[model samples]
Target: MSDWKVTHSPSAGRRPRALSPLREHLRDTFWFAPATAMVGVFLVWAVASEIDTRIVEALQDRGDYDAVEELLKVADDARTVVTTVSSAMMTFIGVVFSISLVAVQMASGQFSPRVVRIFVRSRITKATFAVFLATFLLTLLVLTAYDSDPDPRLVTSVPLVQSLVTLVMVALSLLLFVMYVNTTLRLMRVGHVIDRIVGEAFGAVALLPVGASAEGHALGPETDWIAHEGRAGVLRDVNIARLVRVARQHDVVLRLIPRTGDFVVPGTPVLAVHGGRVPPYRALRYSVSVGVERTFHQDLGFGLRQLSDIALRALSPAVNDPTTAVQALDRIVQFLAALAPRPLDASLHRDRRGAVRLVQPVPGWAALVDLGFAEIRGCAVGHPQVTRRLLAGLDDLALLVPEERREPLLRHRALLAQAVERGVPEASDRTFALRPDRQGIG
Candidate 1:
């Protein structure tokens, strides 16, 4: 198995959805926020200025310079208020706009802290300066427009309403821009990261040959069988990534297989290794399918403890010589028959040719038969029950080993296989009596 680093993500149909790319595009564009505000604010400010000027001119005709001046001063104050409010709003919006991008970057699970800092600074700092400058200029314009006038109020009510509208619009624009950009950025970043991991993992596991030969008469459960037949097997390759992803998506990590209880055996392709990526990012998300077919067949192998070993060790039919080392294997028929799990389950019989003679339905033995059906297709003419039991007493457990001591695991798996063959009654005549050859299977 390849070494893997874990990351979090949601997947769809065994792949992550195209969520990030879409979010990235939408946020950067701001979805028509700040631009619209700029236009609306400018229009309203111009209209308000014109209205105030006309009022001031009318008052000048009444010989009321003092009153005119007072009205102008009020007009100027109103403009200042609009400018200041808009400025603050813009600054707040800019800060949030950049802050949101960081959240998106973090979700991607990529990029260094320095790069993220740069990203945040450019967007927010620029936003703050632009908003403040625009607001100050607008305030100056309003203050200049006001003056004291005796005959009329300092500023017309219309100009006040106009300034308020302009300020609100500008403020709203900044807010909208930040919201749109930030939200989309977050979604897009996480989605892309998740998809990359899943894709890489699946592409790697499709290479194994159904344990032995996926080709020839066996056709290794040819694609069609996987499609139509329910997947019972001599062994199953559980897609662990899919399982974990499903648990996460539902927020319920169901422990279907206990970490310590699951079994893995020799000759059994226990795990499909996952590795390599399809592109610029080498992070791969692969599926390691554990053996489904082998599970029940192995249950059958369990009962053969003393009797089967005793049978294998007998040099002829009557003499026992070998020690207890050959525990990994059992005679194919004895192993299969013992799996009639239910107390009253029927027994499997072999004919003169050593072919399966009969499968009489025993009481409550459907599960055993189903398990047999799943695995029997992989059987050759002679050897019916070859298995790769985990070195952990036929259970899969990662015994912590130093990097240098990986050889012990391999040596043990090979020795277990050899030990089983020594006791086979028809080792010379059995079709698959010969063990499979792999460099480091143990």
Candidate 2:
């Protein structure tokens, strides 16, 4: 039998390669989109101003009194419209985003705080803000272009195109406001949040390379260890290709000691150098990204962590909402089912000559299964809905996952049974909990 077999998964395909630190950090921020929109608005003003000037010159030269009169009338109307828009746009933007921020705060409180990143990274949120700011800036620029002298005949140019563009921008901003409200409302819903988390998790999974052996390729005994030399935080994503190139250059094998999502302190041993001189510590450190908290960029377990956190919060006695916990379990089972058949082995990055340059640790089937199910199972003690759903989830995974991979599911299944028996006093309730129902009580 082949040592490493990669079964096709629904997410099986070419995954995205590691993103540069700059791109990854920017992806998680809210400023870049609006900043870019402002710059683009400036460029648009420049072009529209030039076009308007040319159109006016042509009309004046052609001795078309009627056309010049119409253009001047449009410019007069546009000044009033642009003035109004510039005055109201900032207030509109402030109110909309303030409401959005409140909604996002409530969502973070309702679910997990980690979910705030979703809003920060939302394209709708970014695009809406960008368009709103763009409209405001564009209108202000158009207002400045209007002449101090009011006489239409004496004016060198009428900003006809700028006026039209500003009006169009106002209409677009109003349209996006409706879209932004709808998106923000959906973000508050538990089902939508859970599904989004799962979707993002799949995206992270798609970045991992496939067809690696289950038994990880062995790098010989390490000669030196590279300690982390930065502020303590979670190890996010590493530039695998860059590290591999560095290793290949120095004829060494470098093994990343901490997995993605693992926290590293300044002195934490982050890498192990084997079979050659250690590459520069700065070079190795620079190749990896450490951040304040976990992100979905390359950390598969972070998704599971978010789902579990929501479930645990739901199961808390303070919340007493088993239904929400069941919802969380629904997505958890979905993620695990999709993950069950895929390769969960250490990823080996190699050079062109087939030499292993870097070895990275990946969560195996058991670790992921546990990450998805463990804590919730512990907290699910007295909640029948959550217990039934947990049992059902494990049973489903047991059937779907291969026999060898079913051990963790079976172990959790037995643990669930014992917990149910102890937590449910009456025999009938115990039996009911033991019997699996995909929809919890249903």
Candidate 3:
């Protein structure tokens, strides 16, 4: 029997909505969040300055200039201070950007190039940039409210409150700068990166529903294959809810051809509608979103791919960092443990009447196991530490999963033993590599 079986049957459909393009774009872009915060900060500072200026004017009109006399005395110095700080902040922004870019470049070189996405999408980095820009904007707005010209009747009043607020903003920005540096350093750590990827993978597994069985029901004879008509990219997400609605309306069973994270070229078969009535092509096309790269939003494989990439890169001759590969394997084991008990292949979306509408493709248990460990085992040929770690990970998974799920691990273990025996000519080295130890020491 084939290790991975893809069963095609009408299933109880899930109602997951497709991700909007705007939302997905905003999540990937580094500037949107910070830019929005900057606009908000500018408006807030403008309002506060106007309010402070009005209070001072009201006091002067009421012959109560003494209330703001201290502010008027230092008006000239306050304007100079705000101007200098704003100018200095502009220079500071440039420096922060330069340092951030350098750090990203270094991370990309040290890790896989795709890992740079994690740093760019970091919330701490975006918040730090927003705070710095907000402070600069606040300073400029407050500078406009400060008046150096002395009025003969003392009619002009300085914005004491606004100036103090600008100073506070500067203090906040400095504190955030310190925190941003700490965050950047933490992100560079291999353990932290692996943990992050593992966490996301676990979360994705949890989100997937344990689907009902579709054993007896077979697909209809009449089937219409839907072909993709655009540039090639990874199938990031499918609009399950929308697809279900379309299938129900047309009374057809829509079977997704390419699973999430699969690369589809133009004119590739994407969907198979098993019914007499054909659905609108545009509706079907727009329901699925293709992107330049795979994302963790719904594609669980992408998460595994990331960890696998890190492990492979570490095992490469240029890097040859066995410890890093071991760390990635540790996380991959955790992810597999989380997915062991779940029904991964049968995704069924039903309508209000409880009829199976759409069936989407998902990776089977054996497939996931292969994806998580196969390449790493292939690369661990000469490295005892990585070989032992892979054995240990497989052993741990065997103990955690059910009997039916244990066969793959057991088979892979034999393969690992063969590879180790071949790679290490000495009997003692082979024994050590075959032993299941976290550190690969007998």
The candidate that wins on lDDT is 2
- The residue-by-residue lDDT of candidate 3 on 1-442, one tens digit each, is 1122334333343345444444655777888977897898778777777777787778777877666675577665677778889999989999888988998888777777878878767778888888888888888778766665666245464677777778888888888899999988888898887777777676567655543333434566645688888789999877777888888888888888898889999999998877656798766767878889877766778778889999999999999898998888888888888877666775666776877677777788899999998898899989989888899999999988878888889988989998887778999988877888876553
Prediction 3 TM-score vs. true = 0.88
- What is the Cα-based TM-score of model 1? 0.26
Clashes of each: 54, 0, 6
Q: Tell me the TM-score of each prediction against the true structure.
A: 0.26, 0.92, 0.88
List the global CA lDDT of all models.
0.34, 0.83, 0.78
Model 3 residue runs over 4 Å out of place are 1-24, 152-157, 210-222, 245-253, 281-286, 350-355
Order the numbered candidates by TM-score, best leading: 2, 3, 1
* Residue 360, candidate 3: C-alpha displacement in angstroms: 2.5
Largest TM-score belongs to which candidate? Answer: 2
Candidate 1 global lDDT: 0.34
The alpha-carbon deviation from the true structure for residue 127 of candidate 3, after best TM-score superposition, in angstroms, is 0.9
Ranking by lDDT: 2, 3, 1
- Preferred candidate (lDDT higher): 1 or 3: 3
